[model samples]
Target: MTIFIQSFGYQLWNIITNGPEIPTKLVDGQRILNMNNEFTDHEYKLLQLNAKAKHFIFSNVDRIMVTYEGTNQVKDTKINRLVHDYELFTMLENENISSMYAHFNDIINALKGLGKVVTPRFR
Candidate 1:
């Protein structure tokens, strides 16, 4: 129980501070202001590569893109794993208001059977 609270608190802190930007996308780059007002050639190239790699990975990750029915436009979105987990927690809560450990175990086992990690309890 203590470990669970500690884990929840840590995740909550991350959500408050970093929010979603873990494997930061290209747009997640912060502008630089060097004292010399310029990036070294190597630094510039590294920045370019970072943007390219992030964009490639972002474009390729499945389920990372969401759209409404009968839509052809792709919208810009940030994928936050923590937020998704929180949503799952809400869903499970709605499913089992009794909040019994047995019910929790059933939920976790179902997910495990389907190759998903068990959703932890959090408020």
Candidate 2:
């Protein structure tokens, strides 16, 4: 889960700094993470986790709350919703930069919240 979140953050950073097209290289004449191609494995992993979380009732058992800071205010939200937001934004190919940045910031905040849940020192 952490890897998926970090990878998505990297891709989001690339898009914001460089453009919609992710900067990448050609490997064996095949393009990866380029303008024409995007990575979806992380997204798929998240989807699987989302499904399993529901199936096993893990989402309810765990208390992974995210402190979402919106444009005007801040509030608490469950990590499941943040995961849902991640799935939603990745599919929005035409989403504007500001919205993307908003989601990116929210995800960063979510990561910090998650760190608190995982590491006792953060708590």
Error of 1 at 117 (Å): 13
lDDT tens digits, residues 1-123, model 2?
334334546544333334343345588999765443453666455445444434433343343233223411332345556655555545258878888788677765785675423222322
lDDT minimum window of 10 residues, candidate 2: 63-72
lDDT (CA) per prediction: 0.44, 0.49
RMSD of each: 17.2, 22.4
Off by over 4 Å in 2: 1-77, 91-95, 116-123
Per-residue lDDT of 1-123 in model 1, one digit per residue for the tens? 234323545443333344332222244487434433355766555455555445543564553333332132321111233334334544343465566556555656655554456444556
* Model 2 score (lDDT): 0.49
Q: Which model scores highest in lDDT?
A: 2
Q: After superposition on all CA atoms, how large is the RMSD of candidate 1?
A: 17.2
Q: What TM-score does candidate 1 reach?
A: 0.24
Lowest-scoring 10 consecutive residues by lDDT in candidate 1?
A: 69-78
Candidate 1 lDDT (Cα, 0 to 1):
0.44
